[model samples]
Target: MRLIQIINDIRLKRKLSLIFITVAVLPLLISGIYLTNKLREVMVSNAFEQASDNVERVQKRTAEVINVALDISYQLSNDNRMKSIASRSYDSYNEVIQTYRQYTDIRDYVRLYKEIKAIRLYASNPTMLNNWEFMQPDEQTTKEAWYVSALNKKGLAGWGYIQDERDQKHYLSLVRKINLDDLKNESVLVINVNSDLLNSILSQESFATMIVDDSNNIVAANRPDLYGKNLSAVHAESNMLWQSEGSFDAVMNGKNSKVVIANLNPQNSWNGLRIISIFTISDIVHDANAVIRISAFVVGGCLVIAVLLVYASASLITGRLLRLSKHMSQVGTLSWDSYLDLDGKDEIGQLSRQFNALVHRISQLMFEVEESNQQKQLLLQKQNDIKFKMLASQVNPHFLFNTLESIRMEAHLRGEEDLAQAVWQLSILIRNSLEVGSRQIPLSEELNMVRCYLELHKFRFEDRLQYKMEIDPATEGIEIPPLIIQPLVENSILHGLDRKEDPTLITVRTRLNDHGELFVEIQDDGAGIPPKKMKDLTMRLMDSEEPGNRIGLRNVNDRLQLTYGQGARLSIESEEGRGTCITFCIPKKGVEPVVFSDNR
Candidate 1:
């Protein structure tokens, strides 16, 4: 009740503003917040579900690779030829090589299956020659962990990273004890699984995925650098892999990461492998953040519109009341038909007189303001014209001297026809330069001038200087200040030729950035600016004073800043003895469409 009484005491404008905010803004604000949060939750849930599916897919593929090794092991375990070769003792190396060649099943399996890289049988026969395929185990080989573990497992298969005697490169191999004549640790079959094939399976996965054995040695991984590395060596939060079958959040490689693990238990294997897939949280919900940003922008835009509408409505209501009050106070104050009206210096009468004086003063001010704006416009036009002329004067003398010297040198060396062509091109450049006074031309026309300049230089430099223009077709219709591109191109050629004997390449490229801003770059693969000079030049470009050395460059920078605000200024990137790239960007807001044109 007190709130209602207080509200009633306020003016009608305040009441309307409050009502507008309550009715239009409050509900929208509430719904927008609720929708944003729900959308984020749904996105996160969907990402989790998708990641789970990916893990399952990787598990199936990884199982197939593991099954190949198991199938080969099963087939070889029952083969009589392999059993006989391991059981028999060989007296001579020649006899052993002949016997190995005759028993081709192991070689055939390695050759037939893309999943199998190598197959070796370790026999305990003392007289057997140590052929690579059938190797006699030494004392150290018999005591190794893999060898001892396979012996203890009695014929059950195991997987591990074992060093191959041939290349000495460690590979994920299936190690199993082959029971020959009731001797458990007498013979064994070691089938090295194709590490390339295992890596290929994980390569198809989107996230960083790897296959780790029960021993925590990474057998194969999508990231090649992690192959054969222990789990603890790569990730600090490796303890999560001990859980071995679920998704968990941890820090991997110094980044917050989500890890999903699944076990691959083959048919009769002693130990199964683990499939671990890791992805950063940001990568999983990038699309969600984008959606949230768009939602916030929309909500903020609507709230701004609502506030504006409320202010406008309040101003309209209060203005009407003030006008009504003025008219009411005027009644009985003005008299007609030769009767003298006496006015009191009361509050209402004083307000009426003051209002009239304000009106007269506003009228006079409006007239003076209009006159001042016209003068400013005229002054701006004159300034632009003078600026263009100054920039042109600074460029022509240096350009003409160089161009004429080139033509004279060419005429001396070549035929008169070449000199005529050079002269015609020079005439065209002069005309274009003279006509470019404060007028914006299509980007295509400016690029055409740059091409002409490069062509003339090509005639002078021959193969010493080469240039290419990678111009975006969309930017062709954009209207930009004339002579902006050609001067920069000339600057590149001038510096690019100095202290360089190799073929110099001048690349003039133009494109639009993601924000629809126009970007232009002039690149030169030649001797670059030294760091000290580069620093001095950068500082000089920032000063308001005009530069004496790089006048054309400074002029172009000034004109771009003046026409399109300070965001459009030249940026220099250079490394001494390597190359230099000069780039500039014009903001999207600064690129205005021009309806009128004077070609001259």
Candidate 2:
């Protein structure tokens, strides 16, 4: 009752107090949420944009720098400097090698060769580029991917990696091809790039950036260590089987994260992928406590100051309020020292006016608070709207139902009209039961439709199947939600029936309370759900996966909880032969369009 009175009082004064309280409190709350979400998105977008721009810039710069090196290598490949060695002449090859060593080490030209590790030109098509090392005869092998692609590709290009004499890694290889028709074209002009530099081209600065292949496998990560791991894995629950696109909020190491991914084959190249995701932490757990503390401080401080004014300046209150009003004319620009402009002897009057002004400010804040609360409520409603739609679309039972209806219609025109119409009605009922797109549906509609489906199936098998439905008369007018009962009936039919020769019996019951809620119970007799399968199904429902999980029931459960807060749930109770029963406890609100006609 005290809480109710407080709420009533706030509502009464809501308009007056908005400016002072709600203006400050509500922005802080909303801004707190925006900071947690929007800021991370901004940071990630900026980071990737910078990364792509940097890579392009580096590639352009490298192209310019490497032109000189490629020209020199091309000139030498045909010149007497390299061709002398190509003819297996010791003196010529030795002179060329000495000339190479005098200038700089092998690492010097790597920054120029964007994709070559260590390249040596061959006089004729020698089997391997590595075999013609200048000084130290290292791990020179002709069988590398870069070596093969270089000789074959014949352009300004870079392949992946290969280790050198020092067993150091390198990622680029470049080879220039010659016309060879004019002069006795000796060797292929080759200039290999250093691999370490290639890796450094896109290293991590803050959050990691990774490149995924078509298979969802990470080909490269800014961290380098995660280069081969797959990001789509959830304890092997989801694998990167196909290309996926969108932004989703996920949990990473128990921290809230928003991940956005796009299949990027920029320049329309299918050779690689661009996969980007950003993570941000959210702790409303802490925000709630902060709000409580801040609210206490705000309300307590204002009340304390108000009490002080009443006790300290009773007689001069009206004059003080006027003086304060004059001072506030320059809210942001005024000087506090000149606040007491009154020439009267009533110092107490001046103080009283100022105190009253303070009270007025609090009143304005209260009004603003109400406005802010309304805005928050609106925002929540919008978010729930999307959530409801997502849940409804999750498990689409439309296709199966539509096919059933088609079968029924064909049967109806062929002299089995009663049975066909029954099938048609059952299909329509199932279709109606599949919609989870709303938070609240009318209880009347929910019950009537379930009755249609249950009756249809009940009549199909004649005396072989039986059903009992009970509803509390008082709960008839209450509002509930759509499609909350079908899953319970389904579980009973599929699991409880269990192919038993004994007749099948199912029961559905509903009850309600003054607090505005509905309780629905469904009981069936057949083979009961085992404790193990039941537990697994419950767990899977929380995190639905396709094919092996309870796709229908889990999807329904998710929709129920997400749409109607925590009040709705599905409960199952069954044992072998003395059949099974499932119950859906739903709220007495939001039920509507009680029955969907097959007309659509």
Candidate 3:
């Protein structure tokens, strides 16, 4: 009940603002937030789908490569020539030559299959040449993991990745034990598959992909650095191989990533092979985040615009009521004929008409007095105009310029070159100050004035002041507002340099950017303005109504905006105890001179 009473006491405009926000802007904000969240979720889902597809593709290609290796191993195992050579015991040279010819046929098979790296046959027969294609089982060979595993498997083909003894190159080895009953001898045939073939299958995948064996050792990966490393070393979860198909979030190399694991063929000899795809989640959501940011900005902008429109509409509707209320307060002093010209059938309009009717009856008594007061107001306005013109004329630049010229002449006659130079600079300043006919002058003219002012200050400060002017020749012809650069330079000298004990250095620079825009900068190496003070100064520059000082920084800023648009406005950057820099840009195409009423 208390809240209701307070709301009733509030004005109609405030109630309207509340209604507009609740009915329009509130729903918009809610929907915008919902849509943004939904869009992010959709993007994440799409990324997961892409990762899943890549994993599936890698699984298919890896299965094909493994199947090729399996086919090569089966062919080598079933070859009659391989079995015959293992069963026979060569004695004559011609018999050994025939065995060599049969082994050459096996070599032809390795050459036919590009995936086959090399083929090795180890036998108990001492007559066989222990060369590239044949080897005698030594202690090192028997101790190897592949050799032991193959021997345990007996005649069944065993598959594992191992390094070649000759080149130290990795290869997928298919080892099978052969038992020859004719010679009562046993032999081993090893088929080495090129690891590059497996790498080529994974290379086409876009995401970071890897193939790991049953032992979790990485056989092939897109990044060479990860090859031969354990899968558990990259991702903490070593059980990822057990999962047939799934994705989970994990940290890889200290970065947030999504890992997708898919089993290759479960029935094949390479059943333990798993294709893992890992990608940064941030990379997937980057575009979505950009879209959300833009959407948020648009939503916020709409809300602000809605508030402004509501306020304006409410103010328009309530203005008549306020005017009627004011007239009621001054009813005793109002004339009878001074009626409100409001035309509406609304309650406020009816009240205004009624007030006009009541005032008409009281106006006859004060009509003569109102006429006399009107005449007095007209006379006061005329007096104000005369005073304004007189004040404008009193700002005489000619007197100051002539006095400086006289001083310059006297200094020259007395042979005081430095004094005469300072006097000449002061005269230039006075002459430029008097030229109020045009708002814009050549950038060269403005820079020349700044140079003259700084030179005069250099004379006054002596060794305590150092100045540098670096002006691009291309920017000299552009036109800008007069005194725009000078006041900033003056500000640096007065506020920036005054507090420092060491020598102060001021730099004035102008350059043409790639866009053909002229940028002017003024920097000082002195005690800089504080951050809080710099913020206050920036706010003051933005305020147009309050031109506090006659020749102040705000005055220059307002003039720059008036002559050129907001594009050409002053920007202040300062750090305490470091320095200050004031910069502004001017387009190559000059703007027309805008005549301001407050120029005088």
Candidate 4:
């Protein structure tokens, strides 16, 4: 009877202890889930609100700066000074440059840097800035298209860029055209807008903000070195392009961001230029019901009471399990280099000692993984080395032209004047075809190459092939793919000019567009190709079609795609005998002075 009573009482106590532990665990689990969810929701919402608010502030400030640029153009268009320059003619370039020297302060009106981090270049005659032959901008002048556009358009023309002929400083050009009637000349008044003010605006808003003119070339940026790099989202981390042009939220820089795009032109002109503004995520929401974390005596008073009540049965299991979990979390990612540190005397200590031995086994396996990675990297390095060689050996037609140029020079020295001029022009054409190895080159360089080829054809046909270049000088040195213009010219010649009857005319035109691309048109009075054939030829431009032909046109197009990616391409337009006009656009990439890294 005594034994039966003892056993029954012990069983009842055990049952009671289990019930108490279950009740305690239920509350802890419920509280943990609720707290974790509440905290996450509150913090995430706060992050979103902060990003939105900060970008909104940046958007507003950027607008004011943009308006100032627009207003400067507006004010100058209606200025008495511009009217005076238009009405008078100066005898010397100094007189013309001095004519509107007073307007240099226009830079300040544009919110440019106070210390003047930028400068300007100007020409006295309209043709001096226009006529390709007389314009010699080697490294000191920037030819601005807005100068001429302002003359023709009669207002603030450039928020984009003209050629930076003067290599001394980088600037945003503010140009106005004055007819200067007295001298029978057009004087372009150029104001060099310092980049720092724009940079300051970007600095206020983001870690990095870039301003690209329609040609996609970096015009202004918080990081100036990035200027001249392409900003195509499809190709890089450039923010998603604004299709309809408005503000929106996005994921950027490991956090939320607000991107606002305002069309630079009023009346909601989608086709006109626009400005993109960005702001961070932290500035938007305020913290009110933020979830807070509580630590113990993690278990503290309540856990202690529960433990005391159940210690005789559950203490050993709970302690050992908690210790295992703690070591697991700490060992996994927190201390991969030192997960085997074990020194203790209890049950938890014995488990750690076993874990330390297991870790040593894992370490040997990791050593093999590291060895494999080293081998893989070595192979990758070898592959890249080979690609570098291929880049070098890939023949640029310009190499042949340079050889031809040397022959022409020899001919000139020997009094073969006609042959020398002919080869010189041919060399120029070839150079244009091969110039795209660098990140940037003048728009003029591209056109010059075209003109050289045109001149070459003119000689081949004994002047039957007539060609003219109508390039906006301001477009010179604005940067483009090295081979972008040449291929279009080649296509026009092969499919159009080469088979023309009577005297043929080919014209190459270059202009800056709002989408940040150079609209280059190559037109010819020759038979055109069928649409189907044109498309097929285009697709095969980069792929092999002819076994060993250079497929000069195709090769050049492929290169443009590779060099400039999305914003560069080749297309053809033609008719039976009416004429063929080929238009291809190149986005301006900034100057990368050295083409071959020669790192090897």
Candidate 5:
């Protein structure tokens, strides 16, 4: 289970490699095993059949040799020289010589037939020559198995093993008893068969061959060591000899073997001879084994090549998927200026093309969002400017200035010069305040308006109000929003000085800093606001949110910020019962010129 999980956790390329190997190699392995088994069976069967055929051929050859030997024995039994010798008709040496000459004819038969080793005549006649061609049976010769067996079955041919007197070599002899009643004597004819004939017949076979007699003794064999041995000792089972034809599997000579048994003419002799063939199983299946090895190599090589091809192809495909995954991971963090360049109609290529389109659409939507936001900011700034202008226009100074002019004229006509001057200052102050058409005006003109207003305030308060203006000459020509400074001064008089018991002093100062920023300050020596109230008003000025009750101060800050962005700002410093100083800084180059409509 752990191995399976590990395989599952493997990458797609490795997984595909495994799948390819299983698909390609599994059938090959099964087929190779099946073919090997079938080939082994077929090869072994063919070896058995071939061995059986070879044994049959050897059986036929041995039968032919036995038949030829039997025919020679029958011919010898009827020979006229042997009949004369059996009749004892030869008395003189001349007659014996003639008979001996005829006996030489039988000896010539042995030389003529290669299967016949020698032919010997064993007679009871006294006149027979005891030479190589003829033998007079002695006590030992007559006691021999072949001699005794032949004499018991008179005139009938029989077969047995014997050792030749001339070479002491073993041979299979065909023995027949010759009975001649006219001569009142008996003779035995022995035809010694050459063992090389049977050996040659068995030796021609490819496998080991043995000719076994009825006694289970091996009469002839391809392996000389097996000759004359009991056949049962070689193969534990002698039942194979009884099987006249066919094959079987058995263990022989410490090896697995196929045994084929055949008989050499069972009907011709009572003592049957069997031809047994033994072939080792390994030798029979040798070719099949070679074929199986070659097939295995070929199949293994094909599997390796197939796996390599699968790995390469799968890697190529999965590599594109991995690259696509990487690109998608970077979608929001980086610019989507480019896309995958895989150019094919495959699924991954299609996915890449679609991803590029998606990124392009996203970029376009983001651009639209940014453009919309910029337009909303501009619209908001315009609305705030319009609101500021409307707030400033709320106090109409034209009518008030005209009324002050009439008051000044009346004071002058009544001969009140001091009151008339005060009324004239009031008229000038009102005129300056009425000039609301210009969003910006020169600082000198605004300062003059401030002076007029202060003079009028001083005239009204008498000894209770005192004020001073310390303005820099360099800042006099600087453009500022109209009515900005006067509001701060008005706020100080209304909120701080109005409740003061002692005489109040208000100071208005303007200067340009080294960094080209204009600083304006309104200071009052009067009752200051509480710490909490001061903090609240400071927050109102600094906050960009809409003003609540402190509209005048917030309006001034808003107008500065709208025109000059964050570069222009208002800051207030105050201490309870000490004084209050409201200061604002405007960058010289930061302010934007404001355009005002004459309709206001």
Candidate 6:
């Protein structure tokens, strides 16, 4: 409570300042920092995705090159002629030259395919001459690890960096043992894949990329300086590189970097290669940080402008309110002569003008108080006289009801039962017409009054007039305006039976319609109104003009519209010489409430 009082007591200017700081400044700063961090993350993520795609492309191209070499190796391994040439014992150098010239497939492969650098077959047959395509392995060549491994594998192919004996240059080569059919000696086939092809593929990439064999030797690289170097010498996570196959964060070139790795497993080869792409995270988000700096400057400028605007607006408002407050204090002294004189087109100026009008009104009211008191006494005396007259007017209805009762008793005493019954019914109709005027009555009570009215008519018309009621028991207690149905019943007898000698039947039905609304209908099988008269009656019922005479239909329509709105008005359907039906449905909501009463 004390804190609330303190806050309430603060000046408006200071309150606005606090709101600006908490609502605008703090949230702006927090959101700016959050967005900056999110943008940096998005930049890094996009960089990694591009690098991953680069690695995939390099792996695919590298696989294509390596697959070419493997296919060539398999074809040459199964070549019966090459196997025969390598395994057969040659007696002379001319025979060896002629044989090498005849088998021109190896030379055609290295010449026709850009991916194959060289193809060489090392034979252990001493009689075979050391031609460029077919070489006789010496002691040093047979002792090489690749040669020994290929020999130990018996028939499977192996891939590794092996130097061509002719050029003494190292290349990524596929080494396979080709077993002679009937001989114990095995010949080795080497297919050197062009390292330049792999290097060109990586050079076209944006990030630094390289293909490394399982031995950790960089076979090909976009960076020439890193070629042929072990991965451990250049990367810190070299030991763990083989452990992860996809991507990971690491330190490279003394900077934070993301590295993506993809594997290239060639067909029918013992060793597979890994394609690696590395890019620094800082390089990826460098542009994003510059954009954030400019955005921060713009946001700060806006906040400064907002602070100035808020302060200036607060000062202007508080100054006007303080001046108004001082003048309001003088109003306690009842000084109406001096009014507020503030000026402007704003709301405060309008308030000042209204205050002046109020002061003038107060002064005028003071002068009129005595004159109003003098008139009040005269109105009281007149009201008392009117009340006496209204009381006198109610006495006649009671006297008439008493006189009807006396007549009914006299008829009963004289043994005139029919006359007594007629008198009783007449009394009911007269009492309701006089006392229940324009008030709501229960449908059951209204029906009883209607019965009385109809019975009296029956006494006059005899068999010529007949009436029937089809009232749903559930609608007996529903309230409706008095005389709504009785007037229509009376109209039927007057218009139908009076003009014609034929009999007429009137039906009063009360039931719920499909929408659960109360539907009341009075239908008569008598001579209906003509078309012209019917049109005039409908127009008059809908019009707001005061009906000069025969206001029963118009009055009922007005009451229905006034009580239940326009949708509850009556519908009349009549045809000349046939019948007429007058129906009005009260929405179930309107019938549920007892909305009108005559307390008089």
- Whole-model Cα lDDT per candidate? 0.78, 0.54, 0.75, 0.58, 0.76, 0.82
Best by TM-score: 1
* Clash pairs detected, candidate 3: 336-363
Which ten contiguous residues of candidate 5 have the minimum total lDDT?
263-272
RMSD of candidate 5 to the truth, in angstroms, is 45.4
Identify the runs in model 3 with alpha carbons over 4 angstroms from their true place.
Answer: 1-39, 92-98, 181-184, 241-245, 265-271, 283-600
What tens digits encode model 3's per-residue C-alpha lDDT throughout 179-273? Answer: 65543476777878777887888888667888877667788888888787887776676446466568887777788678899876533342356
Lowest summed-lDDT stretch of 10 residues in model 3? 591-600
Q: What's the number of clashes in each of the models? A: 0, 56, 1, 31, 0, 0
TM-score of each: 0.44, 0.29, 0.41, 0.35, 0.42, 0.43
lDDT of 2 by residue, 425-498 (tens): 77767666566565565666677787787778777667767888787876665555456676667778777665
Tens digit of per-residue lDDT, candidate 1, span 1-600:
665345434655566667677758686877678766867666666667767888899889878887999998998888878788788767887887788778888888888999899999998887677667888888888888999998889889988888998998988889998877556536878999899988888888767888888878899998879888988777757455577798888876577777788888888778888888887755566547656776777777677777776676556445545764655465335411121121333333345566566555666777899999999999999999999999877856657757766776677567687666667677677678767777788888898888888888987988999888999877887899888988888877777775689989999998988999999999998888889988877877777785465547778899998999878988889888888899999899866544435774
- Model 5: how far is 84 from its true place, Å? 1.5
Error of 2 at 66 (Å): 7.2
Candidates ranked by TM-score, best first?
1, 6, 5, 3, 4, 2
Q: lDDT tens string, model 4, 1-600? A: 664334233433454566575647765676667666665567556654543554455456555655554455455545555455445446777765565555554445434534233333333544222222123233233333454455565433455555454464446555554444443554455555556666676666433455666655565666656665655631243444544355566766576666655444432112234455554535432342435424232335557766665664455445555767777777686365655443335444566778877777777778898999999999999999999999999867656766897899899999998789998776665555455465556666666677776677677777667788888655675666565676677777777766766777788887777765667788888777778876766666656654455447766666667766855666666767678887767665532223333682
Instruction: Report each candidate's C-alpha RMSD, comma-separated, in the order given.
Output: 20.3, 28.1, 20.5, 27.0, 45.4, 24.8
Best by lDDT: 6
Which residues of candidate 4, in runs, are more than 4 Å off? Answer: 1-49, 69-152, 161-163, 168-170, 182-189, 206-212, 217-228, 233-239, 247-289, 292-600
Compute the lDDT of residue 80 as modeled in candidate 1: 76
Q: Which ten residues in a row have the lowest lDDT in candidate 6?
A: 3-12
Q: Can you write out model 6's per-residue Cα lDDT over 496-519, one digit (the tens) per residue?
A: 777667888989999988888999
Clashing pairs in 5: none
Model 1 vs. true fold: TM: 0.44
